[model samples]
Target: MDIQKDQILETRVRLELDAKDLRNYAKKATGYSFALEDIAEHLESTVELLKSIEKLKSQEEQDQYQIGQQVVYVDEFMPDTVEIITSIVDGWVSFNNGSRGCIAVMIRPANQDEIKANKRLMVA
Candidate 1:
């Protein structure tokens, strides 16, 4: 399966992370097809690094990551404040008393003419 770089998540990633962590969740889980042979044949990195990362991720035994729980940063959707993504409805994600007191915001999906009006901004 072709993976979108944007949607790829990690249990723990660095700042502005926008990369996917392709690893198995459990012993019974279907493992990733990214073997050292595959990496050597297809990508530039050495087999050792590949094996190392694979070992680390496997030893970690992580789950499907959550939004704020060690997010792989996407520049397009990087929220300065990191919190558990409480709820997403109709494309709008609700935050818990977030920056600028923005409790509610209009939805902004990727496709279509996605735009939002700042409704929570109080006029002084």
Candidate 2:
């Protein structure tokens, strides 16, 4: 068989084994025999749900921030300094200095005016 078919067969076999194990556990724990087919169906649904959740998480991270984008510090002290986004983390963003330094700022998107003003400040 081809690679795709082989992988599908392997996944099905693993699911069947997992369902059987669950059924055995249920029988031992509650003195009742759970249907193997039902268990397998539930497991498949759970796998699909997990895949969807992972996709959403990845999209959320992408939407949070982008590298090389220009943003402004939300501080009164340097409110007009244009900073280039270099990296983003859970609660902060890292910026590269126009020359050779780097600094981290809060992860906040700046408006167009703020970015333009910062650019003007840098020029001045």
Candidate 3:
């Protein structure tokens, strides 16, 4: 059977993003990590309860980075900080403290009429 072109393209992008995110999460957690198949099982899940649980995602994102001027941004409370970055007054970000007492900032952006929304269906 032939594969659909759009699905193949979208799947590649999604896999890339998923790997990046899982690696980032793993790097921040302690000790070893679960198997990739196990992680995929957890990711395929869509339970709201899992969303609230907030367990560590991956073991690579924490232990994998070099710490000399490569980090972009992270909380001071976090360990294994490798690099930090600021937008130099050019970026607008929004954040909320949720139930916690942390301070937060809000951002609102305006776009031109010709701008297009982001999509993961990238073509190589």
Candidate 4:
């Protein structure tokens, strides 16, 4: 995501620079100006908005899980199964149920009802 954002920012910067060059040339030739300056301003605002959105998304993801937190593991075989988070590395979440041991799977933070239901299960 960061790499993609960096590439977009670079492209926007290049476009803004190109727009400025065109504005200068147009002014000299036609004795009038293009709306390139407004376009550049809009480009900058767009970049800022993108950055803000990415930051919010990152923060929301970080707030979603933590080490030792209980979560719901959802997959084809085991939908809404409860598991406990063991670790998170590079956006990969690792979790375990008592029997399965540590395994990485698609997970979401378990809700109160799910947690209560999970607690009612017995080993027998």
Among all candidates shown, the one with the greatest lDDT:
4
lDDT of 1 by residue, 1-124 (tens): 7432222323123211212222222222354454533433333233334445545443332223323431212233444323344443333344552322221221222211111231212211
For each candidate, the alpha-carbon lDDT, in order, equals 0.31, 0.56, 0.32, 0.59
Cα lDDT of candidate 4 equals 0.59
As a whole number from 0 to 100, the lDDT of residue 65 in candidate 2 is 70
TM-score of each: 0.19, 0.40, 0.27, 0.46
Q: How close is candidate 4 to the true structure, as a TM-score?
A: 0.46
TM-score of 1: 0.19
The better-scoring model by lDDT among 3 and 4 is: 4
- Which number leads on TM-score? 4
Model 1 spans > 4 angstroms off: 1-73, 97-124
lDDT: worst 10-residue window of model 1: 106-115
lDDT of 3: 0.32
In Å, residue 98's CA in model 1 sits off its true spot by: 7.0
Candidate 3 on 6-48: residue-level lDDT in tens?
A: 4444555565567657666666756644555456445545332
Q: What is the Å distance of residue 51 in model 2 from its true position?
A: 3.9
List the lowest-lDDT window of 10 residues for candidate 4. 97-106
